[model samples]
Target: MAYDPNNIFAKILRGEVPSKKVHEDEHTLAFHDINPLTPSHILVIPKGPYVSFDDFSEKASDAEIAAFTRAIGKVARDHGLAGDGYRILANIGENAHQEVPHLHVHIFGGKRLGRMLPKE
Candidate 1:
């Protein structure tokens, strides 16, 4: 899928939309989720315009990949979620119900999260 500059995350990156930013660096941005599922729900995203994890991992530069990965860790630690552990997840494609076109990873923590998914 082609990258959409008009996507919500793209808008947030461009400062066209408001976000409760937690951390930001040259290659990545971390922010609080508007509709948080946990006490510390954050979203980490790359600065580049990528459609999903597949798109990002396949196209992003080494520096971008490293920075994006580190940003997620930093955000979790900074938010005090590291001690209790956290869940990092990314939804890819339509079947995964990816709401935004831009690639983003959700960091969920702050309480004991049960199983990732119900048993099939």
Candidate 2:
């Protein structure tokens, strides 16, 4: 499938909805998740409107990918999670539990992350 304008993350990127933003660069945007999984949970999303990681190859440039990963690292370090350890996640497809059809990296820490994933 191709990129869709109706993607929820696109709306967030376009400022159609409100989000607790933590970081933003020319290529990426990091914001707090409304339904957080950890003590400090934020979503680092690309502004290029990618539907998922698979879409990254088509929708993002090499620089864009670098920017996205850099933003993720920054979020972890900036929030004082560098030493404590943090988790970065990107969900893809409906089977992967991607509620929003846009690419995003989940940054979560601030406390010990037990089991590293939610119970299915």
Candidate 3:
């Protein structure tokens, strides 16, 4: 399937839409998800738009990946999830329930999120 250029994440990346920013650098931006899955649910994304996880993993530089991982760690620690650990997720295509085309990392951890995800 073709990627949608007008996704909400694209707007957020363009600054046309507002987001609760948590961390940012030249290559990536981290922010709170408007519709959170948990108390500390956050989204970390690359500034450059990618159609899918495969595209991101294939084209992203080592530096960019490092920066993203570091940022995720920092955000988790800042949110007090270091001791308990947090879940970092990246949904792929529609089968994975990806609503936005842009590549994003979801950082979630707050209460005891059991082994399975919460019911929708």
Candidate 4:
């Protein structure tokens, strides 16, 4: 899918929309989810206009990739979720129910998250 410049994440990055920002750097922006599923839920997004993980991995510069990866780790550690662990999830496509067109990762922690999916 094509990246939408008007996507909510893009708006957040552009400061057109307000977000409870957690971390901001030259390459990324991390913030608290407005409707969190876990006790500690944060969304980390790249500053660029990438539609999905595939898009990002294929097109982002090495510096951007490194910065984004480090940003995720930093956000997790800053939130104190590193010890007990956390789940990092990025829904890629329509089948995965990716709500937004921009690439973003969800950090779920602050509790035992249980299984990632239902039993078969």
Q: Hey, what RMSD does candidate 4 come out at? A: 0.7
Clash totals, every prediction: 0, 0, 0, 0
Q: Quote the lDDT for 101 in model 4.
A: 99
Best by TM-score: 4
TM-score of each: 0.97, 0.89, 0.88, 0.98
State the lDDT of candidate 1 residue by residue for 8-75, as single tens digits: 99999999999999999999999999999999999999999999988898999999999999999899
- For 15-85, candidate 3 gives per-residue lDDT tens digits of 89999998889888999989998989999988776777789778888887788778888899989999998
Q: What ranges in model 1 sit over 4 Å off?
A: none
**Candidate 2's residue-wise lDDT over 2-120, tens digit each?**
57887777888888988889999999999999999788999998898688887887768999999998999999999998998998888788778877777888988988877756799
Q: For model 2, name the residue pairs that clash.
A: none
Task: Give the better candidate number (3 or 4) by TM-score.
Answer: 4
Give the best candidate by lDDT: 4
- Give model 4's TM-score versus the native structure: 0.98
Error of 3 at 62 (Å): 2.1
In order, the Cα lDDT scores of the candidates are 0.94, 0.86, 0.85, 0.95
Candidate structures ordered by lDDT, highest first? 4, 1, 2, 3
Runs of candidate 4 with Cα error greater than 4 angstroms are none
User: Could you tell me the lDDT of residue 83 within candidate 2?
Assistant: 95
